[model samples]
Target: MAELSAPTGREPGLRAVPRPDGTMPRALVIGATGYLGGRLVPRLLAAGYAVRVLARAPERVRAFQWGDDVEVVEGAAAEAAAVRRAVADVDVVYYLVHSMAAGTGFEEADRRAAQTVADAAAAAGVGRIVYLGGLHPDDVPLSPHLRSRVEVGQILLDSGVPTLVLQAGVVIGSGSASFEMVRHLTDVLPYMPAPRWVRNRIQPIAVRDVLHYLLGAARVDPAVNRAVDIGGPDVLRYGQMMNGYAVVAGLRQRAIAALPVLTPRLASHWVNLVTPIPRSIARPLVESLQNDCVVKDDDVDALIPPPAAGLTPYRRAVALALGRVEADDVETSWRDAELSGVPSDPLPSDPDWAGRAVFTDARSARTPAPPDRLWAVVEGIGGENGWYSSPVLWALRGWMDRIVGGVGLARGRRSRRRLAVGDALDFWRVEAVEPGRLLRLRAEMKVPGLAWLELRVAPEGTGARYDQRAVFFPQGLAGRLYWLAVLPFHGFIFRGMANRITAAAARAS
Candidate 1:
């Protein structure tokens, strides 16, 4: 494995320790493509540890800014052979894999994966195993998600390998499942009718603090080999969290009313409709909110001192998360992790005659610029840059989308000058991006049908041609009517958009 060069400046609260071989300790992060794991690997590298990542799909991590800095092993944690290969010559193994988003049987899958990893680490003679688990009170009846986390931590500890389990609740950061729920809940609803679980008091930690504790675990005394609960300083209810988020976002005061009739299932559906998070992932998370997740003990502070900057305040954490969102600097999102058990087929893969009538408003324009320049114009569309067509019409559409619990244009594009698969462009999710060739976006707006807006740029003659296609697969008669109703605006909106994009490309060229 290629060694990670030591960073010039060391991260606070992380103590550097050289190995017996006069080299840095090698740490292997399983599930490195995950939100926490993705962020943690870079910290380990900066702290002078030779970092390696084990991911089921290595391509997912390839886009990460630190992708080339660390070694990557392609394999799932469930595979013993893959686990053993990843554990080889590693001092610390971070078992960050979990199956909460996988729906049913996740607990069993997590248990099996944990056992495989722990056993492999023991066989490899790895010094320590660090695992991040959910924080829940031991006295209360834990939700399936929280219970599975605790169970996995036990399996790791029982492997007879010294394991440090850092248990946390509601990680407040951009792209986190918990924080996204809070963010969307506050952003969408001025008056929130929440479930009783929203009243349950819990502690929330910043992702930065979570990373700090994870890095601190590497240098922690080997004797401390048990679960340690970690959380931000404040203890607040889920409702308060939403309100706090509102305050941090500088939005109008949100009034949340707790409703006794709202069940976790119902709340999960509500979260699904309002937030970018799907019901499969949101259901498990909503169920866990019933139990208070505050840190009951402060023993972890002694084992690993708090960072010099100290723990981030709840509101400050929300601000930081929002700032990251606004700046389009979110490193990794919960969506980056694959969601299993939820069966889904790509639009292109679906059967052509799947009882859905497909509609297309395809248009092409010859641009007086090369494919690269035209592609640049394509990538720069949406958000503050607008649609290059009718700004008023786009705003009206966005407002209508927001009224129906859609993401709307406010979510914006993650980058002003680039496009990536899974990045949000207004109410559309980037489905595919091929640099100078193609860009396809799947609409997240509430509509009667599935919609995609695709832009393709190709070298044509002395310059390039831009092909713009607005495709919609209608559900039924309502879908067809919806398409027909919007058909009048197509001539003005789409044609103008194509022309403007061409002009923009020409101007840039």
Candidate 2:
């Protein structure tokens, strides 16, 4: 029950540590920027642990509000230097980094990463290493994905670091791929001819509960170091899960017939053809599903106990997943084909905009100043600044929105310099604001479907490059027509807007 020593200088009680009554210990969470890692870091901090995190993209790590609260070390876990720096002076280490996103040879990459973590943890004199892996009964012939998962855990265990391996099935959460898959399948497909794996009995865990066990595992005595199977309340067949998801999503219960002829690879391809999720992610996921993934061990219950309340039933988890989709609360998705790096040469951009009989006129300008200076001018747009283009046209657009009861340009910024969540900027609501790098605004004005105006300023040469991207999400046939109708004048409007902003910034400078 030893407590982690607290670092000082900054805040009063914020910097104070609990008396090391041998109660709490320090934890270092690798992959702290990932979905599970993101959730776990805050939980550990709340549990009174001086948590440190090692992230490949430290900027992304710093962007999270938790970055200020925890020590952020920027580097990959495979890098010995970064691992040594991260693992030093930590009681327990959480190895959560995986190369699943690295395309092929994911198994080999995972093995090397596990070894790196184990070696680094041992060198730094870490007490325990807690690893979260996928669930698959050891008796069954494991798929490559599940095999890699178990092998990684084995490597960690063999590292001579007292390791607690938690084997979990599909995690149901907002950002989780498994949950999103269930949601998408149910939402997009009313009827499905599924593969034989549809009969596979899988016990899916909620992300909240997975996090609970992980945090609990970190605090458990180093003496308890063994792989434990973890799952949710229900052990339902994959087909049943689909039915449950459809019900929760307010969709008609779809009929799924298991076909023996449909192989996992073929099933994966089928999924890619229908759902937004790509084959690269879908194939591995579908392949893993061929094996029954129900929990075999009940040891985790003794350690962490059942999650308190609001434990999402399979139905409720599906409901939440669908709810997230409706609310546009997506954090990341396998549908993000851009980052996948799939070969196609001139990789097409967001198809939501392209192939449409619409107009998209984009304009960029260069300014002789830091990105911050350029962004300052861009941010000061709309309202009193009058959009830096045609004041009369901006007013007319506002008038049109007013006729339709939309927010229009009436909603101005809360403050000139400071911006917070949900703040308004003329006809747009600030969707996201990344200080000097990006400022994205969602148009609240009446549009065809969804519309956004994003201004990105990146430092280039001696100055900054200002790029303005105007995105329009059309609804149906009428939306397409509206876009096409306005296509001709977009060139003039967008170009004028971009140049004026640059000119305004130049004058201010």
lDDT of each: 0.82, 0.70
Best by lDDT: 1
Clashing residue pairs for model 2: 1-22, 1-23, 2-22, 2-23
lDDT of 2 by residue, 409-438 (tens): 644443445443334465565656788787
User: Highest TM-score, which number?
Assistant: 1
lDDT of 1 by residue, 424-458 (tens): 67777776778899888877777887888899999
Q: Which sections of candidate 2 miss by over 4 Å?
A: 1-24, 324-433, 436-454, 457-509
For residue 120, model 1's alpha carbon misses the true position, in angstroms, by: 1.1
- What's the CA RMSD for each of the models? 5.4, 12.6
lDDT for model 1 comes to: 0.82
- Output the lDDT of residue 97, model 2: 65
Name the regions of candidate 1 deviating beyond 4 angstroms.
Answer: 1-9, 341-364, 380-416, 421-434, 438-455, 467-509
**Per-model TM against the reference:** 0.80, 0.67
